[model samples]
Target: MGLEVERVNEIAARVAASSGLEVVEVDMRGSGNKRMLRIFIDKPGGVTHEDCANVSRELGTILDVEDVIPGGSYVLEVSSPGLDRKLSRPADFQRFVGSRVKLTTRNPVNGNRYFEGRLESFQDGRLTLELGAPKKKVKAGDSAPQKVEMDLSNVEKANLVPEI
Candidate 1:
């Protein structure tokens, strides 16, 4: 039987928590015999190959016993969120402060929908970014460019700019 999306997420979250991990995302693609389920997991330090293997083994058994999926022959993949992990929640933005981020706004901010800079601060559902300095400054000693302040509601997508 095909489980509802919410039910799948709930079950995945429960399983992940019991295994000392958090489910960052769950994506199901294709259908019928070609179904694929990809689960992103994370922890304080990081996840190893063993961690992925363990979660896959345990979750697979649980799903099989529960009959959560509708069809046959589906692939389940469990792994770390990775270096360029997507920022999907408010906590994600807060946790990644001081890191480089590439973001797109739902509407233009400063006549632009795209922005790439160092995340300076995130508070009260707002984001501040240091976009570096402009090439020309009026005086010998002019301040570096002012930070860009944006509301969280305006963000369409954001991702950590991987260092390497």
Candidate 2:
């Protein structure tokens, strides 16, 4: 993370924590006059519009006063992670154990880089996935394994598979 992003993240975490929220992710995109700062936040039951507005109000002020964002003009958007929230951090994987997830690996695992399955467990910087049945029909003798394990380093991207 860049120094500015780290500083913004620190400020965001502080502001979010004050309102009983967790800062899921802090992203700074674009550049120059079109810079955009997006902060994703969450709580047990999910976040509300008021929660987002309040955090935006406070965090934006702090960022401006602290001059954490460098450029004076930038769009600050605060919102919940939503149902299909990202699973980037180890804590995210640990917290969502038993939930379905779709992930792409940095390299192929079992000749496949993509997987969607139940997160059975996360331990020792690795995760065990209980692979779900394939969407396509299986041949007489060709079938995927019931379980697979991979290190967290291999995961390039991952998101919850919303059951609903």
Candidate 3:
């Protein structure tokens, strides 16, 4: 099953790249009656509906020609990582520089297990963030928020917390 899944992703990536889409992730799920193949795609300008449709069409042919999955049938789904996409690598952390992020850590840091702030920069395998909340003020407007800094390893999962 693992080998089959890996091969499917390889074929899917080749096909998707041919169409200008970066294949971010791929996985096969479910059993006998409910097998599903999910593919996550992305690009510099971000993925579009048209991107999914085109990758689907192109990948459909490649999958058929390769005969990668000889099983009865499986569902294929292609999509973007979306706004709150998960960050699993140092590269991912670097990619999201300047965006506000919320992260969960496996162990406590500064007596807490979570951190939220603006991702300032990523260098030398380390990440920097400026954290705090806006101040509330009757005379000025709002109070200054607190600031915090944490290491990337302390991060179990992180995502871009879009401006609401």
Candidate 4:
């Protein structure tokens, strides 16, 4: 199943690249006839409905012809990563510097595992975040640091915080 998923990812990346798109993520879920394959794509400006439809049409046909999926049937979905998109790669962190983000670390930093702040910079596999103001009033002795730094490997999960 893992190999099949990797093959689908490779194929999706190839198809997306041919169309001038970047494959953000490929996910497979469920089993047998109920399996689902989801591919998220993006580009410099953004992704359009036509882009999604075209990739879906082309990739779907290829998957059918290649038999990349072992199951009897599976659903393929193609779309853009939304505004609050995930940040999983180093490039993703670098590209979104200065944007607000929310993340969880694999291990606690300062005894806290969750953080939300503006991405100050990403360099040398490390990121520095400028912590946002507290949601509630802060006590004099409870002030948090203005900034925090951590290695990229420590980020268990991260996502852009949509700025409205």
**Which candidate wins on lDDT?**
4
Give the winner by lDDT: 2 or 3: 2
TM-score on alpha carbons, each prediction: 0.87, 0.92, 0.80, 0.95
In model 3, what is the error at residue 115, expressed in angstroms? 1.7
lDDT of each: 0.84, 0.91, 0.78, 0.92
lDDT of 2 by residue, 57-136 (tens): 99988988878877559999999998899999999999999999999999988778888999999998999999998645
Tens-digit lDDT track of model 3 for 42-135? 8888989999988887777777777777767878888998888877778788888998888888886656666788888888677777775532
Candidate with the larger lDDT of 3 and 4:
4
Candidate 2 local lDDT, residue 124: 88
Report the C-alpha displacement of residue 160, candidate 3, in angstroms: 1.6
Q: Per lDDT, what order, best first?
A: 4, 2, 1, 3
The residue ranges of model 1 lying beyond 4 angstroms of the native Cα positions read 1-3, 132-145
Better of 1 and 3 by lDDT: 1
Residue-by-residue lDDT tens digits, candidate 1, 1-164:
23545667788788888879888888888888888898998887888898888888888888888888855889899989989889978988998999988888999886667778899999999999988544344467755446789999999999888886
Q: How well does candidate 3 score on lDDT at residue 56?
A: 81
Total clashes, candidate 2? Answer: 0
Which candidate order results from sorting by TM-score in descending order?
A: 4, 2, 1, 3
Whole-model alpha-carbon lDDT for candidate 2: 0.91
**Which residue runs of candidate 3 sit more than 4 Å off their true CA positions?**
134-151
